[model samples]
Structure formats: structure tokens, C-alpha cells
Target: MSAKFEVYLDHSGQHRFRLKAANGEIIAVGEGYTTKSACLQGIESVKANAAGASVVETDD
Candidate 1:
């Protein structure tokens, strides 16, 4: 059970996406996009950048 991205339509007819963990948890939620292509691109961008993505520590 590997992590996967899921694209779907929301209540407002906008396209959205989410990354689900192997355990079926919603690890990340994407912003709404006007087109499915953009939604897919968003997923692709995540795939491309997530490998070396960095975290910026901030004061809480």
C-alpha cells in the first residue's frame, strides 16, 4: 500500500486533489484549479519537487 494522489471534483464544480497515505489518510490537500489539466500538473509538480522539498523552520 503505497501513497497515491487522487483528483476529484468538489461541490463547487472545481477540480481538486489530495495525497493519501498507504493507510488511507489524507496527507495533503491541493488547491482548486479551473481545469483538470492544471490539477494534473499540480500533481506532477508535487512529484517533481517533493523529492528534494525542504522544510523551513519557523517560530510557533
Candidate 2:
């Protein structure tokens, strides 16, 4: 299994998504949206923006 995004509904019936690893742990979570289509668009936005994203090293 590969890392994947899952969409689900909250208690308020708003849609949200989580990016989970194959081990079934959530690594990232998405914002709540009023509609499923918009939720999907959020996923697409992540896909589009993530490809070119750069990592920043945080000083400890």
C-alpha cells in the first residue's frame, strides 16, 4: 500500500481529508469544506502544490 488521501465527514457534516501512510497513520490533515467537490479540489491543490514544494530545516 502507498500513502494516500482519504476524505470523510466531520460531526458537523462538513467534509475533510487526511493523508495517511500505508501503515494507516495520518500524516497530514486537510481543511473542512462544505461540499465534497471542494474537498476533492483541496486534494488536487495539495497534489499540484506539493510536487514543487521545498523542505525547510528548522533549527532545534
Candidate 3:
């Protein structure tokens, strides 16, 4: 088993996605999108941009 992305509708009927680990724990979530296609695009953008993403610490 490996990590995977799942797309589903929210309580407000908006399209959203979540990335789940093999253990079935959600590691990440995407914001709601008006259309399913846009939600999927958001996933692709994460795939394309996150591989080399930097980690930064910020103070709030």
C-alpha cells in the first residue's frame, strides 16, 4: 500500500481532495473547488510543485 489522493464532495457539496497514507490517515487536504476538474488540477499542481518544496519556519 502507498499514499494516494482521493476526491470527494463535501457537506456543502463542493469538490475537494485529500491525500491519504497507506495506513489510511489523511496527510493533506485541498481547498474546495467549484468543479471536480479544478480540484484535480489542484492535485496535479501539488504533485508538480511539492517534490522540491522548501520547509520554512515562521513565528506567528
Residue 56 deviation, candidate 3, in Å?
Answer: 0.4
Q: Write the per-residue lDDT of candidate 1 for residues 4-53, one digit (tens) a residue.
A: 99999999989999999999999999999999999999999999999999
List of clashing residue pairs for candidate 3: none
Cα deviation at 14, candidate 2, in Å, is: 0.6
| lDDT on C-alpha atoms for all candidate structures | 0.97, 0.97, 0.98
- C-alpha lDDT (0 to 100) for residue 1 of candidate 1: 96
Query: Using TM-score as the measure, which candidate wins?
Result: 3
Q: Residue-wise lDDT of candidate 3 within 1-60, one digit each (tens)?
A: 999999999999999999999999999999999999999999999999999999999997
lDDT of 2 by residue, 16-49 (tens): 9999999999999999999999999999999999
Off by over 4 Å in 2: 57-60
Backbone Cα, N, C clashes tallied per candidate = 0, 0, 0
The C-alpha RMSD of each candidate to the native structure, in angstroms, is 1.0, 2.0, 0.5
What TM-score does model 2 achieve against the real structure?
0.86
Model 2 RMSD, rounded to 1 decimal: 2.0
TM-score, one value per model: 0.92, 0.86, 0.97
